[model samples]
Target: MYQYSEFDRQFVRLRAEQFRDQLERWQAGQLSEEQFLPLRLQNGWYVQRYAPMLRIAVPYGEISSAQLRVLAHIAREYDHPDAALLAHAQATQDELQASQPGLTLAAPPLRYGYGHFTTRTNVQYNWIALTKAADVMDLLASVGMHGIQTSGNAIRNITCEALAGIAPDEIVDTRPFAEITRQWSTLHPEFAFLPRKFKIAFNGAAEDRAATGWYDVGLQARRNSAGEVGFTVKVGGGMGRTPIVGSVVREFLPAAELLNYLEAVVRVYNRYGRRDNKWKARIKILVKAEGQKYIDAVEAEYAAIVAQDGAPHTITAAELARVQAGFVVPALSPAGIPSEVSITAKPYQRWLKQNVRPHRLPGLSVVTLSFKRPGFAPGDADAATLDALAELADTFSAGEARLTHEQNLALPWVHASDLPALYEHAQALGLVQPNIGLLTDMIACPGGDFCSLANARAIPIAAALTEMYQDIDEVTDLGPIDLHISGCINSCGHHHSGHIGILGVDKDGKEWYQVTLGGADGSALSGPAMPGKVVGPSFSAAEVPDVVEAILDTYRAQRSSAAEHFIDTLRRVGHEPFKQAANGARHAATERRSHARQAEAATA
Candidate 1:
C-alpha cells in the first residue's frame, strides 16, 4: 500500500475543506443546483434515485486494514436516517397512503458498511445525504483515500490487473507504473474537463484481468528481444453505444517514456475529441471517425513534442524509483511444516478449486472471497463485514487486501498452510460462497434500485439468479461461466464482455432485457476475440430467469463435451440453437397463461 506523505495529507485536507465550503454554499441556496452539479460531481457525489450517492475511490483496488477501518466507519455513520422519508416523498400519493409508517425502518438501522463495489474498482454508498457528503470526504481523506476525479469528465481511477504483483506469469510489476500515472493524472489542470470521461488500465499478466483492451488507454507490459521492459500501447477501445477493441497505436514504447507518450495521446484526444455531442464525445467515437488518420496525427504530435521541450513531459529515473519503492513485496518464511489436510466434503473441494489461485511465491496462494450470495447484492459488503475482513487480513494474510474488478475481495498472499483455518473464519463471515467463476458468481451494477439512469433493477436479477442456481451439482456441471448484467447500455457492469451478457432496456414504459451471447473478456483460449452478440428479441424481466435457464440447457445439449465452456460451445455451434430455445421458453410461457385463462372461463 502507498503511504501518504505530509504533502499528500495536506493536499487532501485542503481539498476536503474546499468541498466543505462549496457544499455549504449549495445547501444555503447561494449556489443553484445547475452551478453546484459540476462541483459536487468532481467530489464523487451524485443525486441518485431517492437520495445522494457517493463514490469513493479505492485506487487500483488496493486497501490496507487501516483504510478498511475508515471505510467501515463511513458506512456506519453516514447513512441518512430520513432515507425512507425521501423514498416515500418520491412515491405516488396512493402508494404513500398504502404504506405503513414504521414498516421500512422496523429493523435496526444498518448503521455502517452499506456500500457496493463498482466495476471501476470504486465503492459506492447509495443512501448518502447531501449535507454529509463533505463529512464523508473528510473521513476518506483521513485514511489516504478520496473520491476526486472519480465521476467527473476527468481521468478516473487508473486501474490494473488485481494479480499484478502476484501472478506467476507476470512480466512486470505494473502497480508502480499505475501509481506513477495516478500521481501524474491526479488534479492535472490541463485535462480537467475533457470531451468525455477517460479510463486507463494496465495489464502485466498473460491473462488480461484488467480488461485493458476495452479502455481508452490500455498499456500492456512488454519486453523486447533484449529483455528491456516497455509497453504495447492500445488506444480508443471502449464499450457503451459503440463497442470496439482498441487499436495498437505503438508496438513498443520504452518504460521510461510512458508518461511522455501518454501525454501525447491525451493531447491528441483532448485537442480534437468531439465536445458538441455527449453521445459522440468519448475518444472511442473520435478514433472511429478519424481511423488511421487519428493514429498519424498522434504520431505527429508525439514527434513535435519530442522535438521541442521533451524534458518537461518525461519522468526521471529518481521519480520512477520513488513510486516503485511503495510496492515492496512482503517478507515471508513458512509458519511451519503443516499436518496433512483432508478435503472429504464436496463443497470444500469445490471452494478450494474455485476460490483459490496460485501465487508467485512458492508456498503462498491468493484467495478470492466471493461477495455474491443469495440475499446480498453482488459486490456488497456491510460495515461489520469490512471490519471482520480487515481483521482476517491482519490475522491470516498480510494487513492488505485487493478488490477485484469482478466484484470480489482477494487476500493476495495467504500462506498455503493456513488455508483450512482461513476458510472457517471466512465461512463464519458469509464470505465463503464457493462460487468464484461459476454461474452464480455474477457481476452487476446498482441498477434501478439506486441509479436514476438505470432501465431495470440489476441487483434483484443477480440475487434471483443466485437463488435459482443454489444447487451445487447443477452449477458444477455448468462449469466456469461469467454472467454479467448492466441496467442500461452505459455498461457499468461490463455486460458487453461477459460470456452471457444481459442489458436492461426500457420498452413502452416497461423494463425488458436484451441478451447477448458468446461475449468474453480478453482473447479467447483458441479462437479470435469477440463481443457478445445480441440474441434475437428483448424479453420481459419476468421471463429472464427461464430464458437464461433455457440458454444453459441449449448449451448443454450442443456442447461437444461436459467440460466444454459456455463461450467455447457457443462459438462452436452458433447462436441459432440458443435463440430457438429462448423462443420455445417464451411460447411455453404463453401457452401456460392461455390454459389457465381457459380454465377460469369454463368455471365462470
Candidate 2:
C-alpha cells in the first residue's frame, strides 16, 4: 500500500474544505444548480434515482484498515435517508410497480446504511443525503480518502490488478507506476474535462485480472528483450452502447516516459474526440471510427509533446524510487501465524482451493473474501461488516486489504500458515463461500433499485440466481463461469465481459432481461476479449433464473467431458443451441404465467 505523504494529507483536507464552502454557498442560494453541478460532480456527488450517491476513490484498490474504519463510520452515521424521504421514495417505487400489471417487477425495498464496492474498486453510498455530502467529504479526508474526480468526466480513479505486487507471474509491480500516473492525472488542468469520461487500467500479471481490454486506456507492464521495464500500451477499449477491445498503440513504451506518453495520447483524443454527442463521446468510439488514422494522430501528438514541450512529465528515477518505497512489503509477525490446523477437513480444503491464491512470496497467500451471497446485493458491506473487515485486515493481512475489480475484498499479505484461523474468522463473517470464479460469484450493479438510468432491478435477479445455486458441489461441478448483470447498458457491472451476461432492458414499460452468451474478459480461461452475443428476445424478470439455468443445461448436455469449462463448451459449439434453449425457457415460463393467471380469473 502507498502511504500518504504530509503534502498529500494537506491537499485532501484543503479540497474537502473547499467543497464544504461550495456546498454552503449552494445551500444559501448564492449559487445556482447549474453553477454547482460541476462542482459537486468533480467532488464525486451524484443525484441518482432516489438520493445522492457518493463515490470515494480507493487508488489502485489499496486501502488501509483506518480508511476502512472511516468508510464504516460514514455508512453508519451518514448513509441514512430522512424518514419522510424514504417513505416518499417507497411510495413512488410502489406506484411504478403497480403500473405494470403482469410484470414481476422484482424490485426489492430501498436500502441504505451500506457501501457498495464498484467494479472500478471505488466505494459508493446510494442513500446519503446531499446536505451531508460536505460532512462526509471531511470525514473521508481525515483518513486520506476523497471523492475527487470519481464522478465527473475526468480521468477517473486509476486501477491495477489486485495481486499487483504479489502475483507469482508478474513481470513488474504496477502499483508504483499506477500511483505515479494517478498523481499526474489528478487535477491536471489540460485534461480535466475531456470529451467524455475516461478510464485507465493496468495489468502487470500474465493473466488479465484487471480487464485491461475493457478500459479507455490499458497498460500492460512488461520488460523489453534487454530486461528494461516498460509498458505495452493499448488504447480505445471500452464497453457501453459500444463494445470494442483496445488496440495496441505502442508495443513498448519506456517506463520513464509513461506520463509524457499518456499526455500525448489524451491530447490527441481531446483534439479529435467527438464532443457533440454524449453517446459517441468516449475515446473508444473515436478510435473505432478513425482506426489507423487515430493511431497515427496519437504518434504525431507524441512527437510534438516530446520535441516541442521537452517531455516535461517524464518520470525520473528518483521519483519512481520514492513511489516504489511506499509499497514495501509489510514485516510479518511470526506470532500472527497460526501453528496447527485440520488441513484435511472438507470445508477448509475447499476454501483453501477456491478462495486462496498463490503469492509471489513463499509461505504467504492472497485470499479473496466472497461478497456474492444470498440476500445482500453483490459487493455491499454494511457498517458492521466494514468494521469487521478492518479488524480482519489488521489481524490477517498486516492491516492492509485490496478491493478487487470483481467487487470483492482481497487480503494480499496473508500468511499461508494462518489459513485455518483466517478461514474460521471469515466463515463466521459469512465471507467464506468457496465460490470464487464460479456461477454464484457473479458481478451485478445496484440497477433500477438505485440507478435512475436502469430499466430493471439487478439485485433481485442476482439474489434469485444466488439462492438457486447454493449447493457448492453443483457450482464447482459446473466449473468456472462469469455471470454478470447490469440494470442498463452503462456496463457498470461489466456485463459485456461475462461468460453469461444479463442486461436489464425496458420493453413496453415492463422490466425484461437480455441474455448474451460467450463473452470473455481477455483471461487465459476466457480467451480473447469480446462482447457476448445476444440469444434472442428479452425475457421477463420472472423468467431470468430459468433462462440462465436453461443456458447452463444446454452447455452441460453439449459438453464433451466434465472437465470442460462453460466458456470452453460455448466456444467449441456455437451460440445457436444455447440461444434456442434460452428462448425455450422463456416460452415455457410465459405459458406457466398465463396458466396461473387463467386459474385466478376462473376462481373470480
Q: Which clashing pairs does model 2 show? A: none
lDDT of each: 0.82, 0.91
Q: What is the lDDT of residue 480 in candidate 1?
A: 82
| Candidate 2 per-residue lDDT over residues 440-493, each given as its tens digit | 999999998889999988887898889888999999999999999999999888
User: Ten consecutive residues with minimal summed lDDT in candidate 1?
Assistant: 100-109
lDDT of 2 at 559: 96
lDDT of 2 at 356: 95
lDDT at 512 for candidate 2?
A: 84
Residue-level lDDT tens digits of model 1 in 1-604: 6677788889988999999999999899999999999998998888876778888888888988888888888888876547565546345323422332211111111222477888888988877778888888888888888889988889999999888889898999898899889888998898999999999999897667788888999998999999988999999988888888888899999998888888888989999999999989999998889999999998888887788865365767898789888888765435543434455676667789989999998988899999996667888888888898899778766788998988999998788878877787888888888888888888998877667898876765676678789997898899888899999998888888888899988887666789998777784342333478998788766567778999999989999999788888988898999999988876776676578778989999
Best by TM-score: 2
